[model samples]
Target: MKLKDSAIRPTAIAVQSPASTSTGTTAGTADRAADRTRSGVLLAALGVASFSLTFPATAWALEGLGPWSLVSCRMALGGLIAGICLLALRVRAPARRHWPALCAVAGGTCVGFPLLTTLALQTSTTSHAAVVVGLLPLTTAAYSSVRNRTRHSRTFWGAAVVGAAVVIAFAVQQSGGSPTGSDLYLFAALLVCAAGYAEGGQLAREMPGWQVIGWALVLCLPVAAVGAALALPAEPVHLTGHTIAGLLWLSAGSQFVGMWVWYRGMGAIGVARASQLQLAQPLLTLVWSVLLLGEHLTPAAPVAAVAVLVCIGVTQRARG
Candidate 1:
């Protein structure tokens, strides 16, 4: 997806006071920082794993449902689950003024990205799709830099260019083997998904990340429900045990727990840093696809993967 650079409209990070420093030895401060970093990495890894499963699950569900039906069902189920959890926790409703932003974020991130990606993966290999998605963080960083008009060193732009090249090369290699209309659609979906993610991260700072997502789902449910009802007639295949299991996993792991963890990490670490963790998502998805789906490994896969890793490292260093 082509990343859009929306103007930065002041996130919570901008107004946050600096962390308080207690009188401690230099080594103690270092140790504490290290601990926090490790914890963040652990949480981020969990979030990545949860997200990685989504593609395969969607693939499985596609066997039984149309893309819109699958998406609407997932959203409906996920929103219900999240609502129940939030209500149990007594989460307060956001002020009315926040509704528009919440709706925008929800539409872009929750509805548009997943719906399009599900449609794309209908004919695309999870491996190819995952590689294409590896550029998300760089796209997001580019969006942030552009929005803030933040000056970035030439090296940062160079790394982003290189990362994009690697992804394109990977795509070309996959395309040569078997390029289908669905594959092209999936590629387009990747761009859209990246844009939605970048926008969602930016908006998340203004509203509580979880609340932004949670409420967006709330506002979106009625519309999604209506869409699902209309699309139900086109859902030809009957749901199987495997499909049911996939739906369960998608709802519990990817939508509910994964989103919660991601929002928590974003709240603690700020969007840019939290987004860096997403660099691991595509790689992790590739691993899951191979192990679970019995997909053959392509020779170019590892090379492209390493290139993406290098790019992510460079991007992170640049941000620092």
Candidate 2:
């Protein structure tokens, strides 16, 4: 009778096994999700660190290269590198439907932000450039929210307003209590970069992250090369080590390599959440300015950076 009972219970044991297996699978999926999110965050932070040096490096590079020459050459270099990467990796072109987004990416990042920011750095101190670039998180968050078709609470908007105000005040302080043309250029760069980031992040969801930027750079290659040719200075550049190093990094690091990580992170983590990580950029940029470019920072600059960071954090956490 005991043996017969054990044989009958085997059916129940089989039935329970499926439930246990299902539970294990669900837990495994959750763990994978958590791990992906963590990796995305770390990548975003790395990209931000790479980007923080851009303004300082540009300012340093500008000492030898004319603003137009610097922009044209760096972009051409970036385009060439990106084109080579695309060919090397055998990446397919984005479908025709994605061409519009790719064009927007090319216009905004490959053209607008780099051109505007380089010009802005010409007239602005690296410290001032850092302060202006601090506006990026707010702009990026706004654009990301729109691109993703999400809603933010009033708390988020309020925080953004306050953060913008703080940055504006800091810019004014840097310019003797009035906005300079450099401020306008930097602000334009911020808006254009936000658009590029949001568009590229969306595109990254469908394609490889690096490929999005790589393709866009390739798309702009001819234009960038022609522009560089047109903008060549009459006098040959007396290239210093700093100038050469800065241009190389700007071309390869900021424009291409950094965006690889950034778009990947944004696609994985969602653009709004990823953009929040940029709050740390201002502080990092300040450090770069002081160390790399020998720029002086006003006491207010640090205070404003902290205030903006806190404001961005609040906006990120605000409930809709």
Candidate 3:
């Protein structure tokens, strides 16, 4: 009886109480959530960095290729890269139910944004066009809220508005204080691209992030092929080292790989939070414009940069 009692006491001491287990579980959950947030922020930042160079790259490409040829070739090249990746990995096609969203991704990012923005780049300088694209965060957030039925805090909204104002101010100053025809194309690009981004963010939740962009790229191949076929013959191309390099970056970096991590980050965080990071994109673009495109850097640029950073910090902190 003494031996049996001693063994039972030891067994009881080895077991944890329900309260202790619950507390441990909760702590683990919090740690994981924090890790995810950090990862998402880093990933989103990379995507923004990649995207920041896009306007400059487009400018470089435009030195040789016509707007239609540039857009069509870039899309086709990007799609081919993505399709090869999918084939190599043996990734399955997304469910038929997912096609509509994929089409939106294809139509907006692959077709609309590229075409409009390329056309705008013909008339607008990269610096001017970039600040216009600065509104993307707000547009994307609004689209996500409406489409996904998620709401953000007032803090988030405030920061987004402030950031947008700073960008618009810079754009207005750069453009000589009036709207132009190119502004129309840029604004249209923003709306369509926002739609693509919002849909891609949601789709990332259901599949691997790379796969989402990969499939979207693949799905648009037919359209891109047709565009390239028609546009290449009609439009002119004068390929140079700068143009080739720019085209490669546009196809590989901006279209596929950057967006792959972007969607992943959006899935880790929320679309709204992830997008707030893009407020920095214009300032980054400003730097690229100065370095790569030899565009002038104005005194107001430094001030706007600081303000946008503060706004990004505030938006990131808000729970929404």
Q: What is the TM-score of each candidate against the true structure?
A: 0.80, 0.89, 0.96
Q: How does residue 124 of candidate 1 score in lDDT?
A: 81
Candidate 2, residue 66: CA error in Å?
1.1
Sort the candidates on TM-score, descending order: 3, 2, 1
lDDT values, one for every candidate: 0.69, 0.82, 0.91
Name the candidate that leads on TM-score: 3
- Candidate 1 at residue 153, lDDT? 71
Of 1 and 2, the candidate ranking higher by lDDT: 2
The residue-level lDDT of candidate 1 at 162 comes to 81
lDDT of 1: 0.69
Clash pairs, model 1 backbone: 1-190, 1-191
TM-score for candidate 1, please give it: 0.80
lDDT string for model 1 (145-263, tens) is 66656676777677777877776677667768555676666556555555555555555556655665677677778877898888888777579876787777776778767766665
- The residue pairs in collision within model 3 are none
What is the Å distance of residue 68 in model 2 from its true position? 1.4
